[model samples]
Target: MRLLITNDDGVHAKGIHALCKELEKYHDIIIVAPDDQRSATSHSITIAKPLIVKEVELPDIKSKAYSVSGTPADCVRVATDQIIKDKVDMVVSGINIGYNLGTDILYSGTVSAAVEATLCSVPAIAVSTESSAEDYVYENAAKYIKKVIEVAVSNKLHEDIVLNVNVPPIKDEDIKGIKVCKIGKLQFHHYYKETGKEQENLVYKLEGERVVNHVEETDSYYVDNGYVTVTPLHYDLTNFNILKDVGKWF
Candidate 1:
């Protein structure tokens, strides 16, 4: 399979490099990632400004790689439309530096890249690690991702879905197994702190402290308990059950 790989952690991130090294063994891989970190950029595309793309070489990987001066979604857009000549069989985002579970997916550039691929009518998978540490291990995550990719390639996945995978930061032996779960709702406790004041304008920075609430049998719960969580996600936000009731008012 010809795979287009991307991440929000930039082209030089170890997580992306580890994933490329593992996946390249079986599939032809092309990486188009941000030139700098673009985490939490969501599903935004660079339409107002011009994007800059440059070819880059990473050590120990023979696959073609490019560094994009834009968001994670931009990398996918440029790769599929311009950079890669072959048809992309699959789109895989991340092996991200941090977990994109629950509500975090709403603001995650890692998952957004995969979401963009699904919008383009392609099967996509978003892989993330459950930590923010700089030296988190990715060998186990890479192995798990390879299996997931194989399954996705061999089986017929739902047309309207994309897989969101979160691997815990545990040792290989500590990993219990994989869990196919639902998207959990996690409440993050955050606050805005005043950073500066320029003339009459005030600047504030938003800070997320921690997860205050997490539902059971969710991606977050499973990942926290030492299991890999795979949640099937889609772009449909319509409330079908309430549609008929709301239509009566009209």
Candidate 2:
């Protein structure tokens, strides 16, 4: 199969490198990733400024690779529309350094890249690891990603949908199992706050930390508890239930 791979953590990230290594044996892979980390840049495109692309040299893989000076979403858009020109059969993003689950998906560039591919009518998967430990195991995550890709491609998983996968940080032996789940409601604990004085009528700096989640049976909960969470995401954001209520209000 022809595969297009991308990530939010930039081209030089170990996660993407490990993923490429594991996947190189099975598919014709093409990597187009951001030149720098754009972790929380959700579904954003570079429209105001010109985007640049540069070829990168990797040690083990013989895949075609390019680094783009844009967000993860931009990488997919450009790869499909400009670089490879719809030649890819599927899209996979990440093996991200940290998990993208529940509410975090709203801000995850890894999921956003896959979402962009799904919007372009391709099956996509976003893989992440729930690890903050410096010595966290990534090989398992890579291997799991390869398996997911194989299953997805062979089953011809819905083209207009993307899978958001979160792996536990523990060793492979410690993992309980994989769970197919729905996107559960999780809320952040904090909000952005300005840290520095305004400069030229603009806020100079902002910083914040996420608030702890309050819900159970969520992707966040599963990851926090050492289970791999697989949430299928769709491009449609419509709230069908609210349409009638909104119509009445209108």
lDDT of 1 by residue, 1-112 (tens): 8899999999999899989999999999999999999998999899989899999999999999999999999998988899988788889899898888888699999999
Superposed Cα deviation of residue 132, candidate 1 (Å): 5.7
Q: What's model 2's lDDT at 55?
A: 92
lDDT of 2 by residue, 1-250 (tens): 8889999999988888888888888888999999998988998899999999999987777888999999999999989999995467889999898778777689899999999998888889999885455444677888888888777767879889798998887788888888787776543544556555656554534445545574677787777777888888887779998989999986
Candidate closest to the true structure, highest TM-score: 1
Distance from true location, Cα of 43 in model 2, Å: 0.9
- What is the model-wide C-alpha lDDT for candidate 1? 0.88
